[model samples]
Target: MSFLLEFVRDPLTVGAITPSGAALARVATAAVPRTGSPVVVELGPGTGAFTEAIQRRLAGRGLHIAVEVNPRFAQHLGALHPGVDVVTADATDLAAVLARRGISQADVVVSGLPWAAFAEHRQRDVLRAVVAALPPHGVFTTFAYLHSRWLPPARRLLTSLRARFDEVVVSRTEWANVPPALVYYCRRPVTEAP
Candidate 1:
């Protein structure tokens, strides 16, 4: 918990809480694409909270790729989620990493990343890269602290998402979370908007 808090220290990052409870993981994992053994990519899976949920959902099927910027978390994830492919890289470089892994497209992208903390350009870079790497009907799930606008920072992130993703669905909020949070389940449109 302390490690996560330190990583997500910025108000915009919203990584303060471990949010590692089983129930929370269930909700986050449930939001993934239904396709069996689909290629799923996870960002900033600190200490493997979301990573654990994802492995459970995979049910011994599918490839789980996790990107962690923190060397400590990456090392820990490597040891913990043996089923998952842990990549020590920045989220903004998702496309390159995926390409290197021979991953043409992802079925779902689950992010524990502190998006709101990133500069506008960096956020756009990551979002655009992720979207480009997703197949049609792919899903993107992320969380934000509901009590504070820091997680997604409504005005900033909402606009960027609207422009990048086909549709953005706000899933049930996990008020049980330490700081209370909302999950955003985004999907690629059947066709890109003009």
Candidate 2:
């Protein structure tokens, strides 16, 4: 419906015609601790697929900020999930987005961004922002569609993730998802030497 329409209107931003399924959402958002409050930031949470799972995990604890580039998606998500602090903005501005909220670093970052649709430079820019917005102990989780794993953009994203984080663990492919997908759980941001 709206997801398909958004994809038709802007394939590059929307990426997929359907939202991620519950199986993928659960695996992707597993980093959000069930106990203790943690600042969790969700990038490109279109239609709040991940947002719903995150809120369930939080169980009324922690801050959930969803950054969406599409205003329609943002507004829809905000109305549907009033608990989330939905911001209509680009993912590359992640650091500043958190800063404006009087926060320094996020404990966990879950991304539903379309890395494969982004150009190489745009991918790097967004990854740099994600790394900057995390502390050394922070965790970052994102997914790549299995069908596009060997594509240049996907390869570039994996390389970039490896460079930014000390450890990047790929999850078992979630076959339940349409077209299937795998998650990348990254920990320990590798700060660049000055």
Please provide TM-scores, in order, for all candidate models, with all chains considered together.
Answer: 0.86, 0.98
Please give the lDDT score at residue 120 for candidate 1.
72
**Best candidate, TM-score:** 2
For candidate 1, what is the lDDT?
0.75
When superposed on Cα atoms, how far off is each prediction in RMSD?
2.8, 1.2
User: Candidate 1 regions off by >4 Å?
Assistant: 1-5, 8-14, 17-20, 33-35, 150-152, 189-194
Instruction: Report lDDT per candidate.
Output: 0.75, 0.94
User: Where does candidate 2 stray beyond 4 Å?
Assistant: none
Instruction: Report the C-alpha lDDT of model 2 over 62-134, residue by residue, as the tens digit.
Output: 9999999999999999999998999999999998899999999999999999999999888988888998999
> Lowest summed-lDDT stretch of 10 residues in model 2?
185-194
Give residue 87's lDDT in candidate 2 (0 to 100): 100
List model 1 lDDT by residue over 35-76, tens digit each. 567889998888887888888778888889999877767898
